[model samples]
Target: MARTRCDRTPAWAQLQLAYDNSGKAFDLRQAFAQDAGRFEAFSQSAPYVFADLSKNRIDAATDKLLFDLARQSGLQEHRDAMFAGEKINHTEGREVWHVLLRTPPESSQDGSHRSVELAKVHETLNAMLAFAESVRSDSGITDVVNIGIGGSDLGPQMAVIALDAFATTGKRLHFVSNVDGHELAATLKTVKADSTLFLIASKTFTTIETMTNARSAKAWFEAQGGTDTARHFAALTTNVAAANAFGITTTFGFWDWVGGRYSLWSAIGLPLAIAIGAQGFREFLAGAHAMDEHFRTAPLEQNLPVRLGLLDLWYRNFHGFTSRSIAPYHSALRRLPAYLQQLEMESNGKRVDAEGAALPFGTSPVLWGEPGTNGQHAYFQMLHQGTDVVPLEFVAVKKPRHALASHHTLLLANVLAQAQALMVGKVDAGGHKHFPGNRPSTFLLLDDLTPASLGALIALQEHRVFVSGSLWGINSFDQWGVELGKVLAKDVEARLGSGDTTGLDGSTAGLLARLRA
Candidate 1:
């Protein structure tokens, strides 16, 4: 089927009708009371993750309609086009092939998804892994600082922290993304110049914030009388000439097809690679490859990502939920919410469709949350009592790596109680104490938090975002929304120095003058 915007599909009208008739009033508590098999019907198990979607405000009939929307919207075709490397990122005129970074060397994609790139992909993969191993073995390097912004920083930082249990290299992995001098300054005080290895990550080796931090780091290295630039600094960028000019002898490069948000699986993962050993890193890739294959081969009805994406669309368009709260029950995944904020928002936060036409429906929802138990004390108050029905996603691991069984048991109990409380709330008390029942939520449980499980979870989210963007008919790979402020920043930076606010707006000009003064 040809690619079709969701609104253009016949199923779209049917969905609207369903929402008007039953969807608006569909309650999980009521649904469960009506259907004995609701949990079994709604819940599903993927490769490494099991999702209990029964608590979500969706019924079997509405789910079928959602599946119809997915089919009519040409989601399957769009997904296939991405895997085939057909320049699906039409706005940028590039293929979205970050999936290639995870594919095994022996994996046969014969006559499929541009198999010829496999040899090239593995060559870089082998080299990057070798370098990571070298870094892991180096006793002199006590700290490895990754200096990059956006995808370069968030992806690796999230993974490194998430898989902290797997990192046995006795090296501190630090990430510096902000251009704020204080952030870099604070990090500098923590590590000796000679003991630190800085990985400068920028696709072009000229990203303003990354390069700014990189230059400052270099300056500090020299200021501390540490003169060996080649030994201490490495670049994760394609601009080999620029890296060379910057006085870095070691470098790794990834393709333009790898979007910044999706580049982590590429050499952008060097920090994560160095944190976990070569074997663990490869297992990470293997885990993601397993998910990639599942996405490539699974049927629409059985596909985990498809279900999530369609449900997200339901919440955004029909149900009118404007935001989602991501509550990871594990402390180690504290960065997971921030990582997903970039992953989903940067990808689908668009005002227009792929054809440059304005879209009638909303694209991305506001996603915000902290690690659970912590969040249970914060904004979760509003979630229970507020008028707005923000959907919540609870991620919990079935097993804990730490031996604190009592703490783990308490954590698990809280996560379960939270989901249940949201769905089956108390209301017998008077108005002030009454708890409204039937708040929607999804529970994603992993058997254990390992390198492989983390890989699978991230890949699942990547594909889920893709499915939603595909149905919306937007170029999810390109982030043109992020460019406008950047361009204005350059003009404003110059004005801050010159105090020339000639054509600037009153607000900007006044603010610039005040800052300069």
Candidate 2:
């Protein structure tokens, strides 16, 4: 079936009418007053994650229209296309099967073309995990430094830090993504050459930033009288020849189907595997696979990912909300907002649709936030009283990993209070204290912050992004938008060296001179 852009759908007009007629006047307080079952009706439980979407400004009628819009846009067909391993990434002529990366090996042995791909995925996964196990047993290495940018850095780093409780206790994990020498310099200062392991994680092994850091790290190791480069360094790249040329024999490869942002389930998760050990890594993959199955098999209305994506559309296209705030209550999950920023924006932040036609509406929202209590201090003031109606998502764990009972109680209280404050504002006679309440927020609760729960949570977000991108008629897999800057930077860097500012705009020339000096 040909993909239909959302704006052209009949339900799009119906949704607009619904918004103009009654959806715009949705008051959360009044909705609860009118319907005592609002909480149960709006909330949903998925694999390892339960969501309370009740505080969002949506009634049953609005939800029906949103569901209608999804069907009218052929979302089901697009979703199926992805699962069947069709080339849904039209711009790249590749199938998006990051789902397969987390799928169980034996279960994926069905006699299909995708089975072959799955076998290859399992082969690389087994090799990578074996290497990880070796690293875990090695007492010589004290630190592991991952050198890569974007997906290569974010997914593994975030997962490693988030699952610190499950990590093998001896190794320290450091990530160096930026091209600035200071980042590598700071990391190098922390560990001796013999005690450090460097993992170079570029798919093609030629990403400029990653290669630069890798070269500098190798130089540092040699300068420090370290021998056996192959013993200390490994490569997670498909370009085996290049990695071999760079003295890296230990390499694991993934296919073009694996996009960087969605690659933690692949060999790009080497650091995560090494940190949490092989078994813990497998549990993480299983959690994600469970979510994938849920997304593939569950009905649209009952699907958490679908429900969240539809709500995103309702907020962005109709309610005119420009950004979404992600507040993870756990301190270990502090990097979640940054990880999601890349996942959502980089995937759907497009001006044009799959056919290269300009879109009539916004695609991705500005996804930003700090950790919970910190964000409460910094931006909660604006969230509760700001003019713009940005939706907030709060992720809370039911059980605390720490032993401090009072601290956990306070943390949970603050989380619940923030959600309540957004919906039910305090009314005071004093002018400054007069708070207008009716804001929307989503509460995502996990049983605990384990590998499985974290895996399911991340997969849920990925599928939700897929749903929105599908409805928007966008190819979320390709990231051509990030390339122009790299090309421009090369020119600017040469100009900085030569002091030739020709063909540069005034702002660029001025900035270039200032940066050079």
lDDT of 2 by residue, 1-517 (tens): 5789999999999999999998898889999999999999999999999999999989998899889989989999999999889998888999999999998877646778888888998888999999999998889989999999999999999999999988855799999999999999999999999988999999999999999999999999999999999999999999999999999999999999999999999999999999998999999999999999999999999999999999999999999999999999999999999999999999999999999999889989999999979998899888887778889999999898878759988999999998888899989887577668888999999999999999999999999999999899889999999999999889888999988989989999998889889
lDDT of 2 at 271: 95
Compute each candidate's TM-score over C-alphas. Answer: 0.98, 0.98
- Candidate with the greatest lDDT versus the true structure: 2
Clashing pairs in 1: none
> Candidate 2: minimum summed lDDT over ten consecutive residues — where?
105-114
Off by over 4 Å in 1: 107-113
TM-score, candidate 2, is: 0.98
- Score candidate 2 by lDDT: 0.93
Q: What lDDT score belongs to each candidate, Candidate 1 first?
A: 0.92, 0.93
Q: Per-residue lDDT tens digits of candidate 1, residues 1-517?
A: 2899999999999999999998998878888999999899988888899998899888878889999999898888888888878899898899999988898885565754467787778888899999999999999999999999999999999999999999898999899999999999999999999899999999999899999999999999999999999999999999999999999999999998999999889999999999997899899998888889888899887889999999999999998999999999999999999999999999999999999999999999999999989999999888888899999999999898888649999999999999898889887656776679789999999999998889999999999999999999998999988889989899889888999999888998899899998
